[model samples]
Target: MHSIHSTDAESAQNLTRYLADEEETLKFGKKLAACLHSGLIIHLFGNLGAGKTTLTRGILHGLGYSHIVKSPTYNLVEIYKISGLYLYHFDFYRFNDYSEWEEAGFRDYFNSDSICLVEWPEKAGNLLPKADLQCFLNMFDSGRNIEIRSSTETGKQCLIHWNTEKNI
Candidate 1:
């Protein structure tokens, strides 16, 4: 995995490293979910079996979704309503044609009142909107390494909350 260092001095601005175990991964996801709001878009990047689905499950659980959360590999998209937040999970792993995104009319789902999490976002090419947060997961010796970058102001705010809550 790649080693990263951040020079941002703010307590909320720093690089955090954690063991890539399942529990720790879930904890990170839950912490991230607390700071999420409507209209948020998160792009997930990782190779196969990098735990994207696990992290997403944690996010859905944190959002108060009692039902089982599954990857949208086959369905392409899954919608859930929890705690007054509209959460849309999209998996583009099977996406071969860029036109499928528009043909499916998924862009309309990114409203000001919903949160969208997309996996394999590159599969959509230039058809998708910019992500608020871009998370890259890499496989390591023991497990995985995740690097999260704030792509927008809202994402930066979420990072602030994550930093404060985790004392990172």
Candidate 2:
């Protein structure tokens, strides 16, 4: 894997990392969990087998969730409550129509009391709330490259916190 680096100049807006393998990705997610807070919406973009679920597992594990973490593809969404915080892991891959989002009554899920991590958000066709942070994961050779961008003040603060807390 390529060397991982964070650009301080734009640290408040974005952060990039190259994970050598699944383990690195999980570790990175764990570290990233420290920067998370309630009410942040994170949109994850990646193709199949791109380690999106693996990264989410790491983040959940870092947040002290001990149960098995799996993709919400079949279930559409999974709810986890940890330390008084509500975490909603959503997978919109099965969405055949944007109306399905509203029909499912998921609009209330994106509130100040919860943190929503959405996969295949494009499938929802802009019906979902605006993401505070957007994460892009791409496969590269035998590793993965990830870029996290902040789109709002809340996301910017998270990125800044990540910069201060990141070890790599």
Question: Which one wins on TM-score?
Answer: 2
**Candidate 1's TM-score:** 0.90
lDDT of 2 by residue, 1-168 (tens): 333446555667888888989999999889989999999999999998898889899999989999999899999999999999999999999999999999999999999999999999999988999999999999989899999989999999998887677454
RMSD of each: 2.5, 1.9
Please give, for residues 1-168, the per-residue lDDT of candidate 1 as tens digits. Answer: 223555543323333455468887877677678888998999999998898888888888887787898889999998899978899999999888888888988989998999999999999998999998888888888877877888777778887877667535
C-alpha lDDT of candidate 1 relative to the true structure: 0.82
Error of 1 at 131 (Å): 0.3
- lDDT scores of the candidates, listed in order: 0.82, 0.90
Candidate 2 ranges with C-alpha deviation above 4 Å: 1-9
Question: How many times do residue backbones clash in model 1?
Answer: 0
